[model samples]
Target: MDKNLRIGIAVLALVGFGALIYSSNSKQARQIAASATQAPATQASAVGRAIVEVKVPEFEGKAVLGQLAYVAKCASCHGENAVGQVGVAPPLVHKIYEPSHHGDMAFVMAAKNGVRSHHWTFGNMPPVDGITDAEVGTIIAYVRTLQRANGIY
Candidate 1:
């Protein structure tokens, strides 16, 4: 083929590839936005004598997976066994971290984004990237298990 023809073909291929990438990214963004809109209820409260349900992150039976996630993302500062790394982190296996207090949504938000340390001297928690929201669910489950085992109920 002539040099001009070859260059034209190359340019066309590049444009096609770019379009493909843009479309894929746009599709993913849309899906993510849609799912977030459909996310479950994340809060609850008591109304008079009846208990009101709230929308929050639900781990249910993913405790083991959450534990693995904790190992990968939280263990560094939280300690391998949730015992807290001296002054670096706080103990997660106690009453303070109980579901009623910390809640799954809180954990999910903290993992998805980072948490600002309102009470701790650690300042702010840097975001733990690479771990997906599902992984965050797993981690929360595991932390709940730990709390249960530690007599937090």
Candidate 2:
């Protein structure tokens, strides 16, 4: 084989081996590392020290939990994978409808406040019952994963 081809194959092998090792640990660890680069910016601490960012505990290894929450709470109108079901909701698996515009805090508010019908007649999403803030965070994380996987981010 050519020198370039040999080097490429070696790199691929190394990457594959690394992925295997990462997977063998905990699932949440993999998700955190996978999305570490996409984490949001941090603010200064009260004591002039760098404030440590906290990731939700139950959502630590539970990317699927986000998907499940989306399906249960949002899929009816938002559709599976957040691509929009019928004329009910909008696609969220891209960089367009992002947290920057409709983000973590916004989602929490919307879930609690229920916005007016933006583009559909399906009444606003009433304040969600029984869902916690952490679950909302997980759903956002999972959607971010989809956006990344789809090359939207």
Candidate 3:
């Protein structure tokens, strides 16, 4: 095939892939918006809320310790078992938090330096005070466990 024709084919393929991605993302956004509208009236003012009911599995090893740490430091906002609190924060067990999406280092950075809001309407996250990097790792482990249990991973 001629080089120009080959280049045209590649460009067309890229455009098609981009369109597919855009379509998928738009569908997801619509679903999220629909869910938000279905949220309880009392939670209408919430910046972000639990998108899924998390199933808690038996904790083991570092996960157990991580759960404890998470409860102490994160549950207030993220909610018990990471189900998240209406009017407070978004669920860590949600698909958006899957390891492939956010990664463990994202958690560490969010805890240490805080994060600007991008995924949710909950506004920017303030740096978690007094939590060590090790503690954040444990928290990530805890959240990851919860996510997996909830079929987020």
lDDT of 1: 0.65
Tens digits of per-residue lDDT for model 1, 1-153: 999999999999999999999999767755543332232344222111111112223345687677677888988777665765433565566455678878888878877788987534445787788879888877877877766666666
- Model 1 misplaced stretches (Cα beyond 4 Å): 1-61
* Candidate 1 lDDT score at position 12: 100
What does the lDDT read for residue 44 in candidate 2?
20
Whose TM-score is higher: candidate 1's or candidate 3's?
3
What is every candidate's alpha-carbon RMSD to the true fold? 15.1, 17.7, 3.2
Predicted structure 3: lDDT? 0.80
Q: Using lDDT, rank the candidates from best to worst.
A: 3, 1, 2
* Tens digit per residue, CA lDDT, model 3, 93-138: 8777888989999999998999997766566889989999788888
lDDT of each: 0.65, 0.59, 0.80
For residue 42, give model 1's deviation from the true position in Å. Answer: 45
- How does residue 79 of candidate 1 score in lDDT? 69
Decreasing TM-score order of the candidates:
3, 1, 2
- Candidate 3 worst ten-residue window by lDDT: 30-39
Model 2 regions more than 4 Å off = 1-60, 118-123
Q: Compute each candidate's TM-score over C-alphas.
A: 0.57, 0.51, 0.79
Instruction: Give the per-residue lDDT of model 2 (tens digit) for 41-132.
Output: 45222212211121222333556788788778776655566664333354565444555656667777777677764433344667777778
